[model samples]
Target: MAKAKSLKAGDKVEWETSQGKTTGTVKKKLTSPTKIKSHKVAATKENPEYLVETEKSKKLAAHKPDALKKK
Candidate 1:
């Protein structure tokens, strides 16, 4: 098993999407539950959400830390 990473803003990460493996930069770290880009996300307790901006399109989306991979 692998350990999870605590990502911060500006960190580079990759995630799997419909478009394949997409790379992005961390834009924001959510401390409280919030909605991002119409996606209802919970950032609390054991799960926290991160706002990531895609490197290619510069699109911002909210995702769980587990969805991100350090690059």
Candidate 2:
């Protein structure tokens, strides 16, 4: 099995969207359950998620490490 990628703040990443792929920079790492813009995020220390800001729209979204690709 392929090892999952490890991401950190300031890392450039991209993910799939309805309009196509969206690129952004990692703003923060979430290790605890929390909400972002009304979206519930289930993150834990062992399996954390990322908060990224879109380069174009500056929108924030939470994404799992595996769902993001370094850009």
lDDT of each: 0.82, 0.87
Query: lDDT per residue, candidate 1, 1-71, as tens digits?
Result: 22227888998888899979998898878878887668777788477788899998989888887888888
Which regions in candidate 1 have their CA more than 4 angstroms from the true location?
1-4
- Candidate 2 residue lDDT tens string, 1-71: 22227777898888889999998999989999999878899999998999999999998999988888887
Error of 1 at 67 (Å): 1.1
Locate the minimum summed-lDDT window of 10 residues in model 2: 1-10
- Best candidate according to TM-score: 2
Clashing pairs in 1: none
